[model samples]
Target: MIALHALQYSRATRILWLLADLGQPCTRIDYDRTDAFRAPEELSKVHPLGKSPVIEDNGEMIAESATILRYLVAKFDDDSHTPPRGTVDYWRHEALFDYVEASFAEVALRAIMPAFRGKPVPDDAKAALDIHLNYIAHALGDGPLLFGDTVTLADIQISYIIALLERVGLLAEHPTVAAYWAVLQEQPGYISATRTAGPMVPTA
Candidate 1:
């Protein structure tokens, strides 16, 4: 069985959600955050970066959210969670999947860092975040998911950042994206993952 090192308020839920959607069973090893809201040192024993969502499968350890997602889909999924390998939609899926953490989440986290430190978010940071949000709004258009009605790994990858934005009420300004998130929240896999591992935002 796969062993998942799940950290509280981390991207591990994305993995859990994917596993749920794939009907895969695994062992979940839980970790709590430090008082500073960082992953505990215990997590370092699992991975050098001490980041959450690390998985052990076939005696191989995997790190990074996008890498793990791709690994799981490639190994366990039967193309239900991804598009055909050589299609235009497949390229779009891969692009958005990578963009989630690299572009969107990076700016979203940057904008929220000051608030986490008990300080005000600077105007420049807020501007950057707004730009990203607008891009998402445009991408979303009038849809339920990032790429039509079917839920793909890209949508799963986007959920963590969506939860973060929702937690801070950033979605209030982006109604389309907010509506999209509402739809995602109702996904059975998301519900199961939340019940098993808790919400995606930190509590400490």
Candidate 2:
């Protein structure tokens, strides 16, 4: 069994979503930003950094949400359930996943983090956010999803990142992104994770 250290409104939501998508059963240890993730005695049992989204599988611990996703897909997914490898589509999928994970960091720093604190966004950060949004708009190009028409892991990952941006007022200018977000929200796994994660906090 896999044990997931989860937090509300954190990247742990992605892990939960992936598990739901794969129909895999796992245990969740919920934590909050204000709390110490692991008890003092259990500290060594979890990640050294005590971050959420750590997974313990067969006595091997894995941290980082993307790493967990890749591990789950590789270990538990059969051909019909896994993304294709060594192809154009596969590379495109990889690119989108990279973009979402990297781009959301900038978005969070620029928009969501400030909103969570109930503070005004810095002008410089807002400008940077505009550039980020434009990049996503260009990448999207009126597509139903991030990587063409299929609902790949790229779509799943990017959708949650964009949804977090939306909660921070960064999504209003990107109509294509908004449309893609709506479609992704309809996915069963996404819906399940959203319910568990709840709406994004206005601040970090």
The numbered model that scores best in TM-score is 1
Query: lDDT tens digits, residues 1-204, model 2?
Result: 898877656777787878888888788886655453233334345777656678989999898777788888889854432347787767866877777777657665667677645699888888887787777777766577665565666665666567777776777877777787788778788788767666433233
RMSD of each: 1.5, 3.4
What is the Cα-based TM-score of model 1? 0.94
lDDT of 1: 0.85
Q: How would you encode candidate 1's per-residue C-alpha lDDT over 58-165 as one tens digit per residue? A: 889999988988888788646888777899988988888889987888899887777667678789888999898888778776678877788888889999888887
Return the clash pairs for model 2, or none.
115-202, 116-202, 116-203, 117-203
Cα lDDT over the full model 2: 0.71
Candidate 2 has its poorest 10 consecutive residues by lDDT at 35-44
